[model samples]
Target: MKTNPGQLSQLLKKSLAPVYLISGDEPLLVQECCDQVRKAAKEAGFHDRLTFHADHQLDWNAVADEFSAMSLFAEKRRIEIHLPTGKLGDGRAVLERVLQEPPEDIILLLISTRLDAAETRRKWYKELQGKGVHVPVWPVDADKFQGWLQQRASSRGLSLTRGALAIMSERLEGNLLAASQELDRLALLANGNTIDEETVEQAVQDSSRFSGFELVTELISGRAPHACKMISVLQQEGENPLGLLAVLSRDLNLLLELKSAGGQAENPASFLKKRGVFQPQRARAMEQAARRLNRAQLHEAVALCSQIDRATKGFDPLSPWHYLRDMSALLATRA
Candidate 1:
């Protein structure tokens, strides 16, 4: 009942699962898996598709009725429930009821964000996995990102030379979405030719614009100007403010973790390696930021993040972008 993307593709060719729980933090991988399931279901005659956004106010009764009702034209249906927060809430009870007498003509597809360890232990989650498939996509880390890029290029009928691969992996960093788009662009530009460093240098524009991860790097290196530039580009690209906040928040918390552990006294590379900061550049940046900012400054930066959130939701008079700029200055400025 548990499968990866490769196995899932092969499995789809043989048979479609009656239910699928596709959850992940990586949007590209999650979307791809869902697309595979959708394609398979359509081929298997699940022509009628209905989508519902699961939230606190979701009408579980309506979903229950739809599950029990036969299609007027006798068409197989796929019901997709998207839970962004990954909490079923009251929907768990309704799903349990429906799964007890699993409907043959209806396929249930639950797409969610990352599920923590606790969520997987719930009875409803286990029951769904017992009856169907659970595909949990994990983010490709820095060590594996180049290999992932190479594989993606091969799939697109383009082969990347070693130097080309190095340029792309460094330019794109760990952002999968950017890497994917760059590969698509390369596929067109190569025109059946192998992508060498010269070809890549000519064809691939820097794809790091889509990376929210870079904002953290910029801030830590005491480059407010660069960080501010990233914020402007991200805003122009319609990047989600909350998503950006999540990125900054995560790194700040990690900095706090290091500070708590006497990071200044310890060697950074070894300290970060123990905590899974595999990328040397990132670990160095984190260490610099930790040593540069005192505890009070770090705490104030975190508080400013909260104000940004409040401002975003209209709880504060200031604009979220305004708060973001202030936080950028706070972290990037030398104390």
Candidate 2:
């Protein structure tokens, strides 16, 4: 059956599946799930483990051979297969065939960043649900994220105020990897005391100011100068251009969603919290932006962002700063 990231530990404690198919777009949750599986396997005395990458072309026979061969060193073995790009073809056939006459002392863990579609899930995923575990790692919402942050702080024997949590959540923007890193930094910086809002603000700087939520806010507010300055700062700090484009694309999509939802205010924070927008500042910024930027302008901004994204990813060696400057100028213009 489909399981969430939070319930993974309890599941592992109760049952050990012969095969685990872990899939999701959220890298942090996906990785955490994989870690849990590995840790559980190790604890259960499956010390000998093998890892394979799906992206690297290998003979299917080799994988079959590896599964067939018994480990000389350990009584049980765990094999981890990472499909980073999710190019694993008709794994159902191989898996079904193997599962029919399963190996006695081997467990297989298939980790992927992309989940099968609903149809695929109905077909292969459903079959595996009963026999093996199918864990879907979804992005944590903002409200849940606050609890996670508090738990993380408390685990380190530290405390955080509500305002500090809000600021940290805002700075991290529901990116759990970034949030976790920032929290770790804060834990170290605080050194066994409650972390205050000022300390959190001082700890985490807006690294990519002209991207993601910040970019959306600046463009919406008609603050071209601030956007330009942010772009320069990001460039000087060696931020990747294509990376910036991806962030812009995501932000534009969110703006479109807000625009489509209309002036009802519908709690963008709550909506985005489910999609992993944990920070209060970001939620407020988007709320303000929704009021200011019209649908047409938002659409145009999205188009510009997509074009810039493609250009940056292409072989054209032009300066990314120039493209960013031009985009800023275009965004500055009144609709």
Candidate 3:
């Protein structure tokens, strides 16, 4: 009745459940599970898909009416209810009524944001889980991310070295979408199916005039002019803003961590060594960035990165490049 993202594919192979309740905050993982269910449903001859957004403005009466009605397009239907806020609200009673005796002709797919423990205890969720399958997707955390990456790479028929994994885990951690994209790119460009650190670096370097790491270096080194130029170049080159943000986010987070760890008190090299920043040049650059920027500034820059992310995704009005330039100026500012 209950499963995880990894097991969903196997479960789908067994048989398609009448109901699939997928809840998660991680977009990629959640989408992957949803895709599996849709594919399986289609294969099982459930072709006509109807989607309803369970927002406050939604007419629950219409949703309920649609459930009871026969599909004019196809005999079997796949009904998807998307609950962005993870709350059914008025739809709670409607869902309960619909599921009381779900039509054999329809497959119900309920997708939502991460459901809190309280939400999990709700009658609708309990009923969905009991009746069919509930796949709760969780974010791949720092400790487990590398393992996830290795498995993903293997699935794509790519071999990754330890160093390659480390660099990837450093740059792509906490962002599965970017990680997946990078791996997909590697699958095409990789030579002889083997991906080492150099391969990864080359991939990043080839993307633009300045790679994400180089942009970070410019920002942290307080080279406002060069950093701004790099951002401009990256924008002109049509680089995905998300990729640039990924690298910036990682470095800003590390600087914040070092600041929190009392990194300023110890020798820069020693502190960096303890933190696994072995490269002398990178160590020196991070050390200087840490000293020049305060915790408050780093926090501001981090927040700005979030804004850039939203803008890039069309959630915000301004262009992502605007936020990118602003973030560069903020980080390039001396404490």
* Per-residue C-alpha lDDT of model 2 across residues 258-318, encoded as one tens digit per residue: 7777756666777777655566776676667666667787766655553454355462366
Residue 72 C-alpha lDDT in model 1: 76
- lDDT, model 2, position 185: 84
> Judged by lDDT against the true structure, how good is candidate 2?
0.68
Clashing pairs in 2: 141-273, 169-279, 170-279
- Reference-based TM-score, model 2: 0.64
lDDT, model 1: 0.78
Order the numbered candidates by lDDT, best leading: 3, 1, 2
Write down the TM-score of every candidate.
0.73, 0.64, 0.66
69-151, model 3: which lDDT tens digit per residue?
97876589998987755567888888887767888889999987665466777887777777789898876756788999999
Superposition TM-score, candidate 3 onto the true structure: 0.66
Pairs that collide, model 3 = none
CA-lDDT, candidates in order: 0.78, 0.68, 0.78
Which portions of model 3 miss their true places by more than 4 Å? 205-335
For model 1, state the Cα shift of residue 92 in Å.
Answer: 1.1
**RMSD, candidate 3, Å:** 7.9
In terms of lDDT, model 3 sits at 0.78
